[model samples]
Target: MELLEGNESRCQNMFWMNKDVFIRLCDELENIYKVKGSQRISVAEKLGMFLYTLGEGAGNRNVQERFQHFGKTVSRYFSGMLNVVCDMTKEFIKPSDPKFKSIPPEILGDYRYMPHFKDCIGAIDGVHVRATISPSNQVPYIGRKGIPTHNIMAVCNFDMQFTFACAGWEGTAHDTRIFQSAIHNLALKFPKPPNEYPQMKWYLGPYKCQRYHLPEFRRGAQPTGYKEIFNHAHSSIRSVIERTFGV
Candidate 1:
């Protein structure tokens, strides 16, 4: 707590946000989740500790020692805060208006893309987030990387901001399979395409994507012709998702 209050840079580094934003986020969490301050630890302290653990990706035992709290207490506050944040996700993350008028001209003006991606809203991809689970449930979560993880599917617009995110799929699950499930369950409502371009409602992605696919270059051979152009443009646009994940 004292460290968080020390300096702006220290606060940001510890909590992954400025002090003002952290306080505001806590207030928002309290408004919806209602965490009352107890004699042992105040709500602010609990939130701070949880955020520190999350930002640093530290283990429960490490956080327990850092905050001078028991391991169970640290884990409890962390889980509570995580649940509250998950519940509030829908309220905070949402797509822009379906009209598609808000798209910037930069995406529309690039010659490599231009008409090919004029209607593209963004890109979608899957990322693996490490997870810890009981032995009985660990089999399903072990990913191709040979680690227990959850395959998180997310969509981001050209501005590099996430418009949608879904988790809980086993890391062993294929990205296409997870995407198919999301579509079948109607869990995501993608923006509607313009009336004149009804067929352009989908976003661009790599060849492995089920909804969109770029031409594949043959083994030991370079791509040529329109396939090359299309793949280049598609890669340029789809880099947004990579940048978002990196951040």
Candidate 2:
């Protein structure tokens, strides 16, 4: 708590939020989860311990040492906080209206991206997040990068804000397959275009998806003028997803 009040940068690095935001989130968590203080630990300390462990990727033992608590206590609070956060997802993450027409002007005005991508609502991509699973589950979690990971499918709006995320899929699974599963299981939750203009709801994605693809220039052949222009625009527009992931 003293550290959170001390340096702003340190607070951001430790918990990924400013002190005010952290306090607000703590208030929300207490309201929703009814996390009462125990005789040994306060509610604020429990929330801090859990967020520190999550934001810093620190192990339970590390959090125990940092917070001056036993390893079991750190693990208990962290697990409890995780469950509470999961329960609050629907309250925090929500999609825009189906008839929403708030496309970024930067994208709309760009000559390279305007006409072709005017209907695109967002960009969808898969990222590998490292995971540690049991021995029996390790085989399915080995990604193409030869690491144990979860292939997380995400959708980012034009403003680079995450609109949707589907995680916990096996790393060996194809991105398209995970997307299909999301559509099947959570179709109602996904944003849809209005009934009058169904085509307006589209997401830009990699070539593997059933969407537009950039022209491939063969080693020995020159690309046509239209192909060159289209490919350049496609790459430029799709780079937004990469930038979002980098952030």
User: Which is the leading candidate under lDDT?
Assistant: 1
What tens digits encode model 1's per-residue C-alpha lDDT throughout 1-247?
A: 6765688898898888998898887787677678777899888888888888878878888888888999889988888878878877776566665576765566866776777777787788889999877789999999788989999999887877788787888889998887766655555654334663433235444444222223433333454555555675676688788899999
Q: lDDT by residue for model 2 over 184-230, one digit each (tens)? A: 56543655444434332354433332223334443334434664555
* TM value for model 1: 0.80
Off by over 4 Å in 2: 194-228
RMSD of each: 4.3, 4.2
**Positional deviation of 19 in candidate 2, in angstroms?**
2.1
- TM-score per prediction, in order, is 0.80, 0.79
